[model samples]
Target: MSEVVTRTERPAQRPVHRPVFLTRRRTYLWAAGAVLLLALPFYLDRFWLQAGLFAMAAAIGATGLNLLTGATGQLSMGHAFFLAVGAYGYCVFAGDGADGLTGLGLPTWLAAVLAVLVAGVAGGVFSPIAGRLRGAYLGIATLALIFIGQHVLFNARDLTGGYNGRDVPPLSLFGLTFDDRELVVAAVPFGSAEKLWYAGLVLLLAGGLFARGVLRGRPGRAMNAIRDHRVAAGVIGVPVARYRAAVFVLSSMYAGLAGVLLALVFQRTVPEYFGMTLSLDYLAMIVIGGLGSVSGAAIGAAFVSLLPQILTRYSDLLPLVSAPGTGGIAPGEAARYLYGAAVVAVVLFLPGGLVRITARRNRPTPQEDT
Candidate 1:
């Protein structure tokens, strides 16, 4: 009766793999970067802070461009027009009828929000044409926007202050005004730049996260599909035209927000500042950074925006670079040349742009096959 065999069960084996997203190393790196950013205002001077603010603005604008041009395959040459709208719109909405400029006398915070909305509305007005056009045709169509915008900016003296432009009203929020008024924090003099440093960080963080979410979700898939093959996207029930128009408006809103930050930094909004050259620079940023990549856009923006500043700061020490109007290659021109070469090199060899280099280093390699 005792012939029953005692069977032994093997213990369950644990899973060998961990989730690739947000791994320990990545989490640590992000934490370190955040800490560094938070501490920078205390250590760095105003020059560096302003330069960083410019980079942040550029990043915001470039991310929007990438969404439309890189992800959706819609070429836009009038991004600067929307930027101008935002800058001038804020001045008009917030100004108190001073210096021969028109003003709605709204609160600064409301003006900023309305300025962004105005940019979106401007984009919406152009959507019909954008939805129908593609490739070079679309680009050419958008070029007209620059000319039209410039004309209006010059002629609408009360709104844009004509050739001279207009001053940007200081932004206020939650009982704190972002101006040159000195407020000490932790023994640090928090002026407009210092105060705006924190504001810029928050805005950049929010914009990047929102953009990342959009790219990682269903809308991004639809956009990529439309970019890859429009007819196929439509066949698969994607509303190609509607999506294109919507993206244009969204991109314009982003540019608007960037313009607001820039206006605050400079305390002035100039038509010349938002011109074809600016649009071209943004295109260069996305191209050099990586198409359809959020981080790439930011990286490219910082590189392009900072190169000139760095060169100017050390122009005397650097060969072939001199201060503006010094007969040698100007700092801006030098930076342009360097980045122009970088763009060509990226297109020729690294089609994926700078982001690919980072991705490759971070990618894990497989061990020997069993």
Candidate 2:
């Protein structure tokens, strides 16, 4: 016998949406931050402005390194090599053969673009090796780049100006040269630092946004898959080697752009600045901030880059720190010591990096039954 049954219809549930105010609040915060950054150069002295620019440039490079080392699980100790290529490449392309140096006399903007490309090419040349290796093996292969770059930078006298390095041609964009020409805005005298402040902000913002996109897109998923399990990723039809190579090139290009910005800010391209130490600092940035996170890279870059400057600027006011060469725990040394301790503390406790703190705080609480 067939059983008699009745069916009860339920009302359709609406899709859950976040509170409108939450989105509005984020937009408002972003607007406030942009306004603050734009206004900073007007009130800040040159020293502070320069420091901020340095931080921004470092953040860009660190972001790229994070994409490779953190996201792809590829260790790179040759980031400084690409940066050197960019810095020196710009000097060559824009130098105009002045001061007995070789140059193509190209437009400053074109030179910057070409410099980034040159860096990408450099990475492409090494991509095969990166594709084949992983972990410490890849790192060791990349480390050789630093030595090779050092030799080229020192010996290529006509291109690099030997040990002294070369002057960076002031960037000229749309008839306004980013030099110490003393342009005034709102009664405030604007120099290279002031002009480059806005440029640095723009570059950093663009880089951050692009990185965030990559991190959230399909490439990011493939990268994470490769990172988590290379053989499994390959088995799933992901081109693990190709992705690794592409990411390496992309990371190199980012470092190159950062190098160009740094050269513009300093008005010079020095070989000594782009070294193993700089690469290590970039690693420290990603690790201290949060691996595989753009905001984390920026935050870590700011902390790592600014700490030395802050210590030096206010050494007298702080204990266990003094002016450079004055002999009582020099500010630079002290800064390093402090960051080293911070790294240890972070590894021991906050393995997710400083950004995790905010993430943990922002996480929603689970509701309890009444």
Candidate 3:
């Protein structure tokens, strides 16, 4: 018996304890950002509030597009079509027939819900085409939706109010109405923009969280598989066509919700606003922000949507960028050119869009202590 009793094995190394400050850094940042956003309405003017609301709506729409085009590799050039459906659908559902337009006289909340569902149905109607097509083929097929939607919107005078569009009924829920009723809180008069600010924030947060969950789950994996390799994914038992169709429907619903929010913000729906140009703008947002990511879509939406507003606000101070109808380039046009260049730059150099910058900064260093 060599010493009969074996020495108890000790751990290979001491357990490492991360610093509390280091561990809580993300929580602190999130808290600070939340506090800042919540406090903005108190300090900012109506213009800024409205701009923020627009960004939120754009983020919602862009996130959906990212899911279809970015995550699932399905190209859609008719996102604006679904958005129009949602906007006009809400108007029709909640109009009360008082404005000389067709309406169902439904509650505003119900109208909003129904609008989203209608958009989903629209997507479902075209899902077969989506299932059969890919790349530019799918894009062209979807492009047809934009033309069809435009025709319907302009021709259906009763339901859509023709080219003039229709007024969006203010939402009433939980005894709180989101309108320009001038509710005062802490001495600040809460107008429609102010009231809708919180609602927009809530919607954006919920949509982002839901999208993130989808991306982190099985559906996301399936979408990615289809995106990366359709044939391989099929071989692995993933239903490529079904996933494509489902994602399309999901994306359309997102666009619908965003359209509803935008209608609320604008107080009126306009057919001209939801056009091919609008669809292109959404594609630019996902490209600039980083595709297949909620944060990416949001960041891109803010960048694209806010640039024009910022330029317009400071047109007098900025060189070569002037107010609309001025001698020089208009802020809107200039903003578009700038972001268009950004898209090219991202594709050539960054390849991951704006979100990659944050991801890189947050990534851990291999040399760091465990």
The better-scoring model by TM-score among 1 and 3 is 3
Per residue, candidate 2 scores C-alpha lDDT tens digits across 1-370 of 9987798789997554545555577679889998999999899999999999999999999999999998999999999999888888999998898688999999999999999999999999999999999999999999999999999999989999888989999999999899999999999999999999998998999999999999999999999999999999999999998999999999999999999999998888888888898888898899899999999999999999999999999989998788767768997788778888888888999999999997765444432111
Against the true structure, candidate 3 reaches a TM-score of 0.94
| Candidate 1 TM-score over all chains jointly | 0.93
Per-residue lDDT for 1-370 in model 3, tens only? Answer: 5767678888698555544555588679999999999999999999999999999999999999999999999999999999998888899998899989998999899999999999999999999989999999999999998999889988989998888888889999889888889999999999899889999999999999999999999999999999999999999999999999999999999999999999999999888899999999999999999989899999999999999999999999999988777799999999999999999999999888999998776655544445
Per-candidate TM vs. native?
0.93, 0.94, 0.94
For each candidate, how many residue pairs have backbone atoms clashing (under 3 Å)?
A: 0, 0, 0
RMSD of candidates 1 onward, in order: 5.7, 3.3, 4.3
For candidate 3, the per-residue lDDT at 66 reads: 98
Q: Once superposed on the true structure, which residue ranges of model 1 sit more than 4 Å away at CA?
A: 1-22, 368-370
Q: What's the TM for model 2?
A: 0.94
